[model samples]
Every structure is written in C-alpha cells, then in structure tokens.
Target: MAFDSLGRFGVWRSYTGFTPEEAREYEQLGYGTLWLGGSPPADLPVVESLLAATETITVATSIVNIWAAPAKEVAESFHRIEAGFPGRFLLGVGAGHPEHTGEYRKPYDALVEYLDELDAAGVPTQRRAVAALGPRVLKLAAERSAGALPYYVPSAHTAQARATIGPNALLATENKVVLTDDTSEAHSIADGTVGFYLGLTNYVSNLRRFGFTDADLSMPPSDRLFDAVVAHGTPEQVVARLTEHLDAGADHVGLQVLGDDYLAALRTLAPLLAARS
Candidate 1:
C-alpha cells in the first residue's frame, strides 16, 4: 500500500462538518486525504459525495466502529465504494471505547474476529487500517491491515507505535489542534475539546504513554498533558507541533480542528500546514 497516497496531512473532521464544496476545496489545498472522523455506518455514501466533488483526495473513515457496523455490511459498503471510486477509499476500523460498548468483551479478540470477517468477505488487507494504541493491537495492525490509525496521542506515542508496527505500515496519527493566537481562548477551547475524552478510560490510558500520571489525567488535565496532546497556537506553531509526529515517524497526520468555524479554521490552517509538508 502507498501510505504516501494519503499525503503528509489529512483533515480529520466528520462528514457533517463540511459541505461537499468544502470537501473539494480541501483537495485544492493539497491535503491528500479527508479523514471522516465519526464512526460512520456501513452504508455511508458521504465518501462518494466528497470524491465526486474532487478529483484526487483520498477519503478514509477515521474508523467505522466494529461494534455497530457489522463486518459483512461494511465490506459490502467498501466494495461498493471501491467499485465506483477505485482506490480512493481506505477503510479504518476499530474496537471502539469500552465505556461506549455495552457488551465489550475481550477487545483484542473482538477486533481479530472483525478482521477475520472482513478478510472472509473479500476486503483486502492493504485497503484497511486498524485504530490501534496498545502494543498488541499495534502489532496486530501491522500483521493484519494496512497500518495503524492512532487518535489523541502525542508524538512520543507515535514513535512507539511506529517502532512496534515496524517500518512498512502506515502511521496515521490524529492530533486535535486549535489554530488561534489567543492563549486564553485556545486553552478554553482545548479544555472543552479534551474534557469528554478525559472521562474515557481508553483515552486516559492511552494518554499515560506520554508520561501522564493520574494527577495529570485529572479533569482539565495538566498543562504538560494539554500542550502535548492538543496543539494550540499560531499557525506556524501548530504546524511545528504537527510536524513532531512526522519527525517521530508518522506517515500521515490527521488534523481535527478543535473549534467552531471548521472550514475557516481549515482554510486558515491548510496552507500553513501544507507549507511544511
């Protein structure tokens, strides 16, 4: 798989966040992929809308949660999209959060079963990525899918994931970034953005990899944790923070704009972010 097909930076936003035209403009701005952030259902056709709006940007599901979207249905959806769009869609699948999953048994085993289902249904290994954070899942991703898609992690975790997954697989890390010069507003916005994730054990557990202790995991989080996970500052500063992932061996960085006026933020940010790539 050509991990570079996703380019250096992808906009990680929900399909509901932008209009079809805005999705097209993202392509014009040189982003190689549109990371549709929500765990979309099996019959998601928003991918086609984005592809039709643009000639070249890849549209990847930041993940299609395995719990809700059955593997057979998702594989059929992937097949349908692949038929129309060719190599444009990359499927990202994950075992979702334990907090949200009621019947969440052994997550690792569930993920393996899901992957086996995808494989049996004719989904090629190179066409999908696994949303992995821990060592076992990271290694499983390298062996079973295109690569790893890690969300809410700092560059330190990216480096660790890359080493664990080895050199060949894709490392697409999602970083929540706020492009604002107002320090107070940025922190406020970042705090709101991270507050919900702080309550999720999976997210907080994954964050601990970046040297975050229980104290740092408290509500509002520590400044060290905030600065590491949420990149907020002027455009150049944000770009530098995103670059840390690349330098740490990320194949692609999916930037999820953590503020209102996402299109404006992406328009303001895409060029600056693209300039670095």
Candidate 2:
C-alpha cells in the first residue's frame, strides 16, 4: 500500500527459516519490513504470527504465486490479516516462472485476471503490488496495483522504472548483498546464487534489456555479470551500491544477505543505513 514508514532497508527471508520470534528480533534490529520469499501458500496464520511479533514493522510477501495461491484465497487471507493487524500487511503477488508451474501461460493475462478477482473481492488496489519486471507488467502494475516489487534488478533498471512509472508510484527493488571483503570468495558465493537466476528466462531477458549481451549471460556468469547482479564488498561498499538504487528512484530497497548468517549481516548493515537515515 502506502509503504510510508517501511523504511529503505528491509529483510528478505524465507518463511521456513524465520520464526515469528526471529521476525520480532529483526524488527528490533531496525529493519522496517520483513519480505517473506519462496512463494508461500495463502495462509493468514503465518502472516498473523509476523504481525503479532512486531509492533510497527510491515510484513510483506516478496510474492505469493498466482498459480499456487488463487486470488480468492489470497483475498480471504488479506481480509483475515487486515482484520487482525490493520495496515501491517502488503500483498505482493506474481505470476511465477513458467518452468515451475503447470498453470504458467500468458502470465500477463493471468495477472490481470487475478487483479480483477482481487478487486471484486474488495482488496483495495493500494494495499497490494505485483512482482513485475518487464515494461508491460510494470506499466500494468502502476495502473492496477499500488506499484511494482521488482526482484533481482539493478539500479539502472530502477532508474528506468522510475521514469516509466513516474515519481509517485512505488519502486521497491531487491539487492543481494554479501558483507565480505574477499572479492574472489564473495563472487563464488554470488555465482552459486546468481547461476539459478541467470538460468531463468525472465531474469536473463531483463538483464539483456539492461545491455548485458548473450556472452555476458553465458554459463558461469562472467565477472561483469556477477558484479552487475550482486553487490558484494565491505558494508560501506554495499551501502554505496544500494544507495545507487535509491538515487535511481527506488522508494525502498530490500537487502538480501547472500551468506548463511543472515542475522549477523543485518546487524552489520543496519547502523550504516541508520546513519544515512
């Protein structure tokens, strides 16, 4: 919705890893929002735990797959969570990858239909957003929903999206961060994670649209590819990179730690972001 106080820094965690208590700890750690990833099914109980744990932080779905969680079911969950914890939930829904779902066909049409269903069910357009990347979907997101929650995109793309969606529409982007100074090792970890997304057509296409070529998108992503996608360095360096997104017109940037020790990473970066705030 109007993510007015969600802050610029947020945590991107999987629901399976973070318990409600852990979520509360993150809120205390100064992260303004908790973005649950991994296409969780429509279950308000899980959302409720997150809302109950934090007093003011917002809980959002990085995305609930439109294929798996139907609009009606999502709307029902939305109402339940809203009734229990008003103004604390933001629904981020997406048409998941075609390779992952049998129902993945004409995702644009599917998203439109889902939005129509959400509308008819009384879920306000301002309370939700779509996980959009391309121009068409991005434009549709501005028209039909609150704004766009674009994942795995860079600051350059954010600049373009900001121009396209105008200044008022929300532009929230996710950046993978590794708070390590070791360039080689950091890139290795980034490659392992980047490899999966590089293989996804939607991500690859978006990267190409941003000027990376087929050679750049080749297997075992080139150093250029890795650098463009992952922002790895010291905390200051990471903050510098993330600031580019905000400068490029992002309303908020969700920082996803690449390493296993997520809480430590959050603790490390919070102060730097706080200083800027």
Candidate lDDT scores, in order, read: 0.88, 0.86
How big is the RMSD of model 1? Answer: 1.1
lDDT of 2 by residue, 89-195 (tens): 88999997987887679999999999999999999988898998999999999899889999988788999998888778888889998889898988777777888
Residue 211 lDDT in model 1? 74
lDDT of 1 by residue, 208-273 (tens): 766789888888678888888888888888889999999999999998888776667778888787
Provide the TM-score for each candidate, comma-separated. 0.97, 0.97
